[model samples]
Target chain A: MIQFTNISKSFDEVKAVRNVSLSIDEGQLFGFIGPDGAGKTTLFRMLNSLLIADEGSIELFGLDPHKDYKKVRQIIGYMPGKFSLYYDLSIEENLNFFATVFGTTIEENYHLIEDIYKQIEPFKKRHAGKLSGGMKQKLALCCALIHKPKLLLLDEPTTGVDAVSRREFWDMLKSLKSKGITIVVSTPYMDEAGMCDSVALMQNGQIHAVESPKAIVDNFQKELLAVKCNDMYKALLTLRNYENCYNVYPFGEYLHYIDKRDSKPIEDINDCLLKHDLQEIEINPVKPDIEDCFIELTRKLSV
Target chain B: MENEQVIIVRDLVKKFGDFTANAGLNFHVDKGEIFGFLGANGAGKTTAMRILCGLSSPTSGLVEVAGYNVKTHAEEVKKRIGYMSQKFSLFEDLTIWENMRFFSTVYGMNKTAFKERGEMLLRKLELFEKRNRLVSTLSLGWKQKLAFTVAILHEPSIVFLDEPTGGVDPITRRQFWEMIYEAADNGITVFVTTHYMDEAEYCNRVTIMVDGRIDALDTPAKLKEKYQVNSMNDVFLALAR
Candidate 1:
């Protein structure tokens, strides 16, 4: 289990994280959702003890990260946002090094990373840098797990990785979680937020909302509508100009708009667009997803 | 000539030493099209893009970009194309205005024309107030938008974007695609590489690469239909996996 109370961190003039608090239950899969400058990385570093918080305290497994970092480092598996694995070293060599550094051998904790390691085992001799993005990611996870750590902290593990590979990686994480490893992952992709048992949406270094994906979606107050027309760009602009429109943005091929009114107002919306002579217009009431909730939540924070 | 082909690659192969980075690739990008180049890392997307951009030579096969043969007219091809890599191709130390001026001149834009267009662009993006701020000071989304605008500053016939939306938030990514659509509307071809499958849906057409070879190429809808899948992500998995 991990807990942060009123934690804050700053670098020069930028307050990366400000007055944030959250508690993660043991063996639970948690996600930190935010954009690039939203301070997800800073919060992860504080938990990893790589960077100390400017204020407040952090407790991991009833131990202070700053005071007991030595034990913290041993039990926590960290895959930084950037690939910190040695590019020149072979995959097998990197695994050996990590295992040995943790005072263990690959054979001792082989079962911990068996599923992931097998994917990259065929290319065990390939240099880490030469491997594909997916292979390197698996290898990194394997290295982080070689010592059989109790917790895993992966920062943006799916960024820059193709969608298929990203799905595969998440599947691997799910399996890892089934083994009772507490996983803390951070990502900017809102779709991935649903994969977590619970998520803490952070923005501008503050935690806007923390809840299950379903809870967040259920909490979305606005009535949602999905509209598709001949010209998507023009439709987006026109929809944004509607009087009752609270938010309108592109979602795949359709422009998902949230109305300020409680009702869907399909007829009024149609009449508004009819005046513009848009073709192939289709408007339907739709359920909001985690992304819609996230956008709505963050918009409120900004305003 | 309604949808003229601006990029053509036939049996294109690129090898380094004994490694074949690109293997017998064939694809064509239409003018004014939003073309998606997608693949797993190490699938040879970068190698093929470099060859098309005239930054590297192909080992064999015919390739043309912007009406010029990449091999024989590398210089000519370079002039008519713009490229922005994932890292955001901008000088971090330079102010926004300075970076804009520098890239326009590099593209051989007239000094007077750049002055007028540069101001207009900054104002349109609402970055005119921060024109003197260092590029590094801007947020990730702002930097990406600026890099994109600079890439097309000269109105190149084709602009190459190598994973332009990596690590950006959803709202910013959507806004960035609006910019891409705007460019395509102006008759400038956009050849972009991205990992987000949702982005592929916005493209006019997409090509998926696997192990140094193109596995699939068509409009997002067509590919999804051909693969009997519901999304581009599923289509890519069907081909690449």
Candidate 2:
């Protein structure tokens, strides 16, 4: 449903996207996983035809975005990274405004956003700005889906939202996807990447890898160890200084450490920490997740 | 132990007309501790934080920071505390050095001290060469770390961070928390609010606010064990429910 061929975009002297090419199948939920300056926003803007690419080409359902952006927008729903709803308008008023803009009525496309709108209907009279972060996101999603668009482009919809709200938002997207709507979401959260059918691991305006979360993680070249001790801060410092330690990062309560030699470096790690008077040291072998894969990929890119 | 309490609150209450934003909130933060404040949206986290930071007046109760009463000495409390919100307070158009100079001057730092500290900070962050570059040109990760450096530049006794790692990548967020850890190691207490459950796990202790009151306050491991959960997210869901 979406295709890009050697697409390149630059802001002044910096290339926001460079020779990137990718495709999204119809009805598939695609995630662009990357950091803030990773060009996901720039690429999304180009797809929406809000910004024109400096080079290469883009096709939306076999139609050139640059040549047919007017009609293309009618079938695509976009929620920008920053909330763009009318803060002064009531929730119901915002929905009505969005429906009217698309030359439709809320009743006609009520099923499209029924599940989402039901969550925010109680506060229909409240101003959009007065709603909570989760409510605002639901209201925004309702507005975006008010016209029953075929595709949805959500940019970091769960950013800054609580974990519960984030889960609910993704569940809403899953329901929408079941209805045969293609969704392209950009998020910095690596955990959310697993929820997508396929994701493009992007960094520095380049697509490092494009695969299912499982496949990407399964391809992790190194074995990982979840390292912890009585004193975590000192453990991290000691692990970083270990001769065979390739990378040491804080992962929740424990540190994720990678070794240069793959042959069960647990004894070596234990000895290194044991020498530092660290006690109760625990090192467990683990599988890499999407965040670890992304970090490793970005590290490779940097080097 | 009593002297270690950098922040002490007793029955703090804040009401917005009829709604009780903070319902008799009470907590104590020890010196050089990383305290995590976790809650659902509109769960009174921001309201309680505002009261602690002296940005909002509580309806009733005692609130103290750095051994000074928040009500009677808001200015004094503000001077000894640094705050960095999710939306950073840096001048985008200004160069890195100019932004540092502006904030230091606002905090009444002397010229010689500001110059020495500013250069040292930038070099440590590897941004010394880009000191003349506009802040707007820096990446989000760079800007976040820089903003954090600026927040603690004045050597405040406590730093209040409201979701300081919002919208940042996982790698960068980890690095940002490293800076927080370094500050706490240097004897600067950190009182931070975060939505990430994993981040809450990094704190020395965490308070979970629900419906304008603290539902639970304890270390992350204890909370998880008490709730029979493996992660802070589950513990939060249990409390919020």
Candidate 3:
């Protein structure tokens, strides 16, 4: 449904996007996973015709965004990373305004956003600026869906949102995807990559890898180990200094450790930590996750 | 060093007109401890944090930070404590060295101390080569690390970080935590607020807020066991939902 061929964009001297080529099938939920300045926003803008790419081309629903800007805008809904809505207007008014701008009415697209809009219906009279972060996010989603566009583009929808609200927002996206709408979203959070049908790991304006979340994790070449001890900071330092240590970083309650070799080398890791006077050492082999894969990919790129 | 309470909040309540942002909060953060403040978007985390930082006054109850009552000793509290948010704490237009000099001067550091610590920090962060570069030219990760170093440049007893890792890459996020760990080891109490549940596990103690009250307060391990969940995210979802 969407395709980009050798797309590249530069702002002044910095290359915001570097020859990125990607495609999203119809009715698929695709995610661009990267941190700020990773070109997710630039690529989105290029797709929506807000910014023209310095090289290559973009096609949405087989229509070139540069040439057919008006038609492309009509068929695609774009929600920016920063909340972009009529803050001075009430929640209901913002929705109505967006609908009218898209040549539709609230009554016409009510079913498309009913599940999400109903939650904020009681406060429809309240100004958008007065709403909290979660409420504003919901209202933004409602506004984005009011026109029933064929494709939805959300840039970093869960960036500053809390964990609970982030999960709810993902669920809302999933429901929208279930309705056969092609959705493309971006986020800095690696864990959210798992929720997408496929995710493009982006960094420094380049796409390093794109695959299903499970496939990405399975493709991790390292034999990962989770190590826990009484003093995690000391243990991390000790493990990083180990002879066979490839990479060791803190992950939640434990430190994710990788050895230079393909083997687990659990006893050697435990011995290294124990020799450093670390106590309560526990080492277990653990499967790599999307965050681990992303880190590994970035490391490979830098190397 | 072992059990000294750096921050003490008892029945802390903050109200905005008729809205109660914080309702009867009672907690204490020990010296050299990493305390995690977590909650939903409107769970009053910011209000409670502001009161502790002496940025905002509490409507009722006592709130002490850095061995001073926030209400009467707001200036004293501000002098002894540092604050940094994800939005940034450094001047974008100034070069890295200039930003450091400005903040150290604002914190009233001696010339000798600022010069000594400033060079040490720049070298440690590997930003010494780019010291003359403008802060606006640095990447988000670099900016956050620089902001963090400058926040603790004054050597405050406690530092308040409001979501310091927001929108940062995975590698830099861990690196930032390493800096926090180093600060705590140096006897600087760290009070951080974050939305990443995995980060909550790194805290020595975490307090989860709900609506306008303290819903759960305990160590990550204890909270996990209490909620019968394996991860802090599940515990947070259980309480906040």
Candidate 4:
């Protein structure tokens, strides 16, 4: 369990975090979803007691993070966004080092990371720096879990990883969650937000919304339209210039279109594209996803 | 002219001692096409891209980029192609204008041409006022957009982008794709790699690599139908599994 009351932090002129107040229940898989410079890292550092907040208070399991820094660190496993491990050391050595630092041995918590560590056990003798990106990630997770911490703080674990590896990493997290560990993760990918039990969408050092992924998507008020045509690029330009067009962006194979009218102007949109000499235009109303909701939230803030 | 092949790779094999990074890759990228290069980690996407960009040599087979054999005319290939990656592209310590000037000079652009084109581009991206600000001062979205603009500043025939929008926001990511679209429309071929499945759908053609081999190659629609999936994410999951 964790709680933050009116948390505000600033570095010189830029406010890294702006009065963010959030709480995570025990055994909940909470996610901090935002892009780089969105204060996810800052919030994590503050919670880990590595960075002091400019104002407000933070409590981890009813214990103040700053006042009880040592105790807080013992119960929390913090994985920074940047890979922070002994690259020169072998995988086994790195895992042992982390376990020793936490006043524990690998045998004491072998069950905690056995599912993940076993995959890289064959290459335990290899240097951490020599391992590939995915291998390094697995090793790092094993290190983070070596102490059997009750809370796991993963900062953008899948930021630079590929799709397949990202999926694999999420599966591992789900398994860890099943073990009754409170997992707090951050990522820039909106698609990953769905995997979390609840997510806080942060942007410009502020939390826009904190709710279940399904609730966020259901809150999308606009009637979104997916438009596909022979020439998507030309169609995007044409749709952007439409009089009632509020926002038009390329979403995979089709352009997601939204208008400023209450009634769905599908015919008018089709006519506009047709007048622009676009062909094979197919416009259909589609459900909004988490990314759409996040974009709408950010746009609302700017407006 | 539109259908002209700008990049041709045939039986391209790259070996690292006992390991074969690229077993045998055979593909051609047409002019003005957005080609997506995708693969799992250690799947040889980087190996093939390095060979195509002339950053590394192939063990065997013929690889040509920008109408020149990369094995022999690596310099010519480098001259006609621009490369940018998510990790490293621009100088963070340097100001926006200085980074642009440095890259332009490396690409052998004249002072007058660099100044005119750089100013125009900065103005278009609405960063002319902040040209003197260091790249580190700007946000990640701004840095990526600037890096992309500078990548195409030299007017390369083909641009190589490796996970260029890795951590960019949703809105800025779409804006970056719009830039790619504009560049391709100007006859500049785009060779990009990304983890976002929705992004793979935007490519004119995509080649998915698996274990140093080309697993599948086709347009998004065709690949979806072939794999009996609704999205590129499913297609990738099916193959990479």
DockQ of each: 0.58, 0.62, 0.73, 0.76
Better model by lDDT: candidate 1 vs candidate 4: 4
For model 3, name the residue pairs that clash: none
Better of 1 and 2 by DockQ: 2
2 or 4, greater by DockQ: 4
lDDT (0-100) at residue A134 of candidate 4? 85
Per-residue lDDT of model 1, residues A239-278, tens digit only: 8898988889877767898878886588888888888888
- Enumerate residue pairs that collide in model 1: none
Chain A alone, TM-score per model: 0.97, 0.97, 0.98, 0.98
Stretches of candidate 1 exceeding 4 Å from the true structure:
B9-26, B57-62, B226-228
Q: How accurate locally is residue A283 in candidate 2, as Cα lDDT from 0 to 100?
A: 94
Error of 1 at B191 (Å): 1.4
Q: What's every prediction's RMSD, in angstroms?
A: 2.3, 2.0, 1.5, 1.5
Q: Could you give candidate 4's per-residue lDDT for residues A49-69 as a string of tens digits?
A: 999999999999988889999
CAPRI verdict (incorrect, acceptable, medium, high) for model 3:
medium
Rank the models by DockQ, top first: 4, 3, 2, 1
Candidate that scores best on DockQ: 4
Clashing pairs in 2: none
Residue A250 alpha-carbon offset, candidate 3, angstroms: 1.4
